[model samples]
Target: MDIKLSNKNLGLTPSVTLSIDAKAKEMKAKGINVIGFGVGEPDFNTPDNIRLKAINAIENKNLGYTPASGLPELKEVICKKLKKDNNLDYEKENIIVSNGAKHSLYNVFQAICNPGDEVIIPTPYWVSYPELVKMADATPVYIECSEENSFKMDTEVLKESITKNTKAIILNSPSNPTGSVYTKNELEEIAEIAVENNILVVSDEIYEKLIYDNFEHVSIASLNDEIKDLTIVVNGMSKAYAMTGWRIGYTASNKSIAKVMSNIQSHSTSNPNTIAQYASIEGIQGSQQFIEEMRLSFDERRKYMVDRINNIEGLSCIVPKGAFYIMMNITEFIGKEIKGKLIMNSVDFSELLLEKANVAIVPGKAFGSDNFMRISYANSMENIKEGLTRIEAFLQEKTE
Candidate 1:
């Protein structure tokens, strides 16, 4: 029997990160030792204080459906945190909470994008952006950023990508797949371009609290009022708070935009989990000492992993300024034979690494870069050391 699937269902691709993670889990179940560097999640448990808050909420019978935009108290806390940390002012009415950062982003697209609209996305972006744009019935236009520019999209390229049909541009800092964070000057230039063109900017700052080495994250909307009116700031507690499983995220924007997002949420998931919202109030309002500790650990691992990969033959990596992933360029290994198997691109190279070294990493092709692969340093220091050592040995053996 043949089943007909709708175009919307047919066009979607399974998440590449999940696919690699599933393979790693299968290998582990078969009793093979596998070190997974493919997942984008943090390795730490959710903090004790936050967990206690959630437990208290359960005891208080806080499990019912809250407001679709979020609990009022939680929204107020979020607004206050925004003012204190990012120097941005917002009222509770300007915020809309969702299941996670991903949900907030998708809802934003659904609320704003009309069919046939174009969305400008910088390449080596988060894997879900282009697909989400497609799901919204919009086209995704890619602007390639080279390694010479630290993998950041220049203002000139952004300006050129805009057309009468372009509705929005998606920006991710402390970017996934590549850990490139934009500088204040670069952000100002991009904001200027967006203002000139009257295009919307959807800034994903989920990794906002993970910056290291004296680098500061300046919100693009905070540059000026005009930019603020045109930008939607998407953030969550996943990375910084190590609460990925809790799935609490929010967006702050112009009142009209927030209202529309809330309406969309009202029909769709109707509110995020009530306990998660209660816990998120604690997350945003609590002390950030845990975030700093995690950031320092990630910084050390980032430096160590980049140095180790660069020391291996036929592999090279640029030191990332923020975030916990290293995008390693493996162009030198393309077209080589690995154990009689043809290695042609990042995908082939990743499979060879898994088979030969028992190390799992995501291919850059998943993120729209062909000659590179992403290695996440969210594992323990010992695991990172062992994985890279195996990678180094695998390369050396192949070369010999």
Candidate 2:
């Protein structure tokens, strides 16, 4: 029998994280003790109050389908949260909820992009952005961010990338692969470029609440009225509220764009989970003390990981000002052999570390960066210590 696949399906690449996760599972099943760090999820469980709210909803028979866009109460709470936190004003109609920030973003790209349109994505971006763009039949134009610039896109490079075919640019703060948070000044410069080119800005602020050291997260839409109209802000409860499994995410944008996104959602997944929507309303409207506690914990772990990684003989890491992942440069260890296998690139390095040291880390090539690897600090303090110790010993054995 012959099987056929659509162009959309053929365009999509397998998820790199899932591939690593599957390999880790196979090794673990074979009795290898693997410290898996390839996951992009938080190690914490959903908060008790949030879980109870969902449970209460389920008990109350709130299991019916929701509005195609979202629950009215959840949408209202999201609007309020946006205004309170980001100083961005939006009516309830301007928001559309989805399964996760990932779903919301995929919908947004599907709604806005046309075939052959170019999306300017900064390199070392989230692994899914380029794939999603391709799935929409759009081209992903990479704007490389160098290590010297702290892995942030240069304004000049951004300006130069705009062409008539360019339709949008994706801005991810506290970026996934590299924990680089764009400063207000940097965002303003990028906003100027976006505004001038009439390019829509898809700001992924999923990690907004995960910042450290008083680093402010500025919404590009808040820069001015003009920028606001062209900016689509995507956020959700997954990272901050530890509700990854709940699958509640939303976006605030121009009313017309919001409507288009909602229409796309109507045909796609229809609506987010009803219980999750109810829980997310509580997540947004309830007390935020838990968020602060989590942020503080991540800050401590980030400092410890960066310091320890830098102390290693051949590995150098920059102190990330925000997110919980550290993109450490392992270029110094390239070309070296471990256990008779030569480490040629980030992929080879990650494989060697996993097989030899029993510690799993995501290679930077997944995020479009080659000479580095992302080590997430989202696990426990003990796990962080053990993982780093294994990494250090592995490197020492190779370099010595």
Candidate whose TM-score is highest = 1
lDDT of 2 by residue, 1-400 (tens): 8889796878687777778878989999999888877877777788888888999999999999989999998888998899999999999999999999999999999999999899999988889999989988899999999988989999988888989999999999978878889999999998998888899999999999988778889999999999999999999999999888889889999999999999999998898999999998878888888888898998888999888988988889887877678898989878878778888889999888888899889888888987899888988999899888998888778646
Across residues 152-265, which tens digit of lDDT does each residue of candidate 1 receive?
Answer: 998887888889999999989989878999999999999988898899999999998888778889899999999999999999989999999999999999999999999999
Question: Which prediction has the highest lDDT against the true structure?
Answer: 1
Candidate 1, which segments miss by more than 4 Å at Cα?
Answer: 1-3
Instruction: Give the true-structure RMSD of model 2.
Output: 1.1
TM-score of each: 0.98, 0.98
Overall lDDT per candidate, in order of appearance: 0.91, 0.89
Error of 2 at 333 (Å): 1.8
**Model 2 ranges off by over 4 Å:** none
